[model samples]
Target: MFFKRGMLVTQAILLNMVQLLTVLLLAPLVKGWINRSNALFQSRRGPSVWQPYYDIFKLLRKDSVIPEQASWIFTFAPYIYFTVPLVVALLIPVLTTFPLFMAFMGDMLGGGFILSLGGFFLVLAALDTGSAFCGLGSSRARFVSFMAEPVLMLVFFTVSLVAQSTIPYIVNQAFAGPALILAPSHILVVLAFFLVVLAEIGRIPVDNPATHQEPSMIDEGRTMEHSGRHLGLLRWGADMKLFVLLTIWLNVLVTPWGLVGSAAPLAVALAITALLGKMAVAAFLIAFIEGCFAKLRLLRIAEYLGAAFVISLLAVITYTMGI
Candidate 1:
């Protein structure tokens, strides 16, 4: 019995790791597709789907540069930064639950709360580097996180209200449960989660993903001193971050097929396909939104996030009031 249990745990862990890396590998393709779409819109030639993979291989082969004045933390930050989000990306149900992950942070409410921990460390690690860009990015990330968590919690709560369970799988099951139609709270939560997605991912009207704006770029502002392998990890980590969020939304609203791990090979294959398809759609939607909106002033970030908070809070209140 002990050996069988150990084997099961090992299999689960290895499967999670593989899935995490697979998401990393797919990240660049997702970016490439968006770039291709945007390029077509601009009437410019776009790069190929293989571009991101090539870039990663090239970056990995190159030697890394570490500034002499930089603290050890700055040098080490990229590895931890990369791996944590990868773990997180796999922890959430993308196509299916891995079982062990849900065993640990199983509750959607708890999982949402746990993201703040990652946000906290990401910002702190950036600050530890002591670079102005890093500091600025970290600061903005902090603010966005503040707005994102409550919205996520409220969203989960709304689901829980209908399902009577905060476990993601349970809430997912709630989709077909009582109150299956669009509830007011559900609508508010969805809107709030969508906005939170933008802010959390450093999208427009909150922060620009592709900007060197001295004071405004949230994700890139950090790691100004990182180079080569470190930069690769950070970049790769970012893709995982985007993928994870996409997975959460996909599982929450779209297909909750496997809240527990799939048994048959065919089922797992189908689940993987469903995940990739959803991820592609999400990436396009996010890219579309980013292309349509101008970056907001740092001061106006509050207005955007404030609205998300209002929607989220209203979701929670509506859920609690059973309205």
Candidate 2:
């Protein structure tokens, strides 16, 4: 029995490692695909889909520039931001429907808190430099976060009400049922969650990633003071955060159809293929939105998120009332 338990632990560890590497390696590719798709929608030839990988390699080979007045927080925030998503990757159902070794360490709420911890430090770092642009961007970012958090909580409430658990793997299993997947409350929650994702990831209708203008900058402005390897880490971390959120949205909140069910090598390979295919479809939809929609005026941002909150709240009400 002891030997059997040891082997189980070993297998879980190996699976966890696979999850980590998958997040790290594929994140850039996902970002690149989004950019390329957005460009295609505009009838322009964009950079190759592998461009993000090249950019990261170039940034790592350069040196980071430190602001004269910066403190330890500035140096520390990048590392924290870079590491939080990796921790989240372990907590979520990334590659499998079964919980891995570290999965029990944190449920969905705990993982959300960990992701917020990274953002909190990043806000501090933005303020640390005392740059007008960084401060502007950070304030806007915080305002957006302020608006989005309630929707996120409502989404969690709705999911917990439906699945009766905050654990991601269990949530996925619960969602695998057709009855639950097609429920009115589930559809409402998915719509709400997708809106929150765009706000969180600094995508269109919230912020324009393609625009670096200081006055209009939201997400990019917070990291303006960073350069070289530090910037690389921040950028890569953002990409990984996007990948992680989308993975959760697809594998847990949307459907767990493509996830590997057991520890078989062939199953894992097919699961990876299906996962990438799903990601590509998601990327195209995001690109379509970004291509067609303009960023909202800063003052109008709250209204946008408020819609998400209302949708999420309705999801909870509907679920509880058996609608």
Candidate 3:
């Protein structure tokens, strides 16, 4: 019996490792797909879909140049930025619904906090460089985060009301139920969360991922001083963050089908395929929206986020009304 238990533990550990690697490796492909889709909408051919991988590889092979005045925080921040999302990925139900290693660490609320912690570190790192661009970017990033975080929390709380717990897997399982999907409250929550994802990933009307123009940049400004491996890590981390957020939006809140409820191999394989298909659909939709909308001015972002908050609040109110 002890040997059998050990074998089960080993299998779980292997599965967890595979899931982590999958998230890390697949992140860039999602970004690439989004970029490619946007290019197609513009009637122009873009860079290869595998361009991100090659870019990272080139960056890794080069040496990073640091400013003379930069502190240790500036140097170490990229690794921290990269690691936090990887940790969150483990906690979320990316590949399988079954609880894996580190499953007990926390639930959906805890996952949000972990993500916030990483964002905080990123802000500090941006400040550590003392560059005017980084400072401006950091300030704007914080402003958006300050307004968006509460709405995000509210969305989570609204969803939790239905699941009766904050655990992501349980919430996903709850969302998979036919009754919850059709609930007016749940539908509102999903819409609100979709808006949040746009802001969180620095998408259109919030921030542009492809621009270096100072007037319209938030995330890019923060990384202006980083080069070589540091830049590689930062870019890679950004991609992973996007992938993780989309996975949560796709598998947890939006389309919660085909997620493995058991440890069966075939079920897990099918779940992964379904997850990719959903991601592709999501990527195309997001790219189309991005191509259609212009980036909102910094002050206007407040109103955008305000609308999200109001929508999330309506979700809670709707739930209370039991409609």
All candidates' lDDT scores?
0.68, 0.92, 0.87
Local accuracy of candidate 1 as per-residue lDDT tens digits, 229-286: 8777777776666666766677765555544365455665677777777667777777
Decreasing TM-score order of the candidates: 2, 3, 1
CA RMSD per model (angstroms): 3.0, 1.0, 1.1
CA deviation > 4 Å runs, candidate 1: 1-18, 97-102, 109-119, 176-181, 257-261
What is candidate 1's local distance difference test score? 0.68
| Residue 33 in model 3: lDDT | 91
Most TM-score-accurate candidate? 2
With a 3 Å backbone cut-off (N, CA, C), the pairs that clash in candidate 3 are none
Across residues 1-323, which tens digit of lDDT does each residue of candidate 2 receive?
A: 99999988888888888889989999999999999999999999999999999999999899999999999999999999999999999999888988887888998888888987888899999999999999999999999998888888889988999999989999999999887999999999999999999999999999999998899999999999999999999999999999998998999988678888788878887887888888899999999999889999998989999999999999988988988
Worst 10 residues of 1 by lDDT: 95-104
Ranking of all predicted structures according to lDDT, beginning with the best and ending with the worst: 2, 3, 1
> Taking the tens digit of each residue's C-alpha lDDT, what string does model 3 give over 44-76?
899888999999989989999999888898888
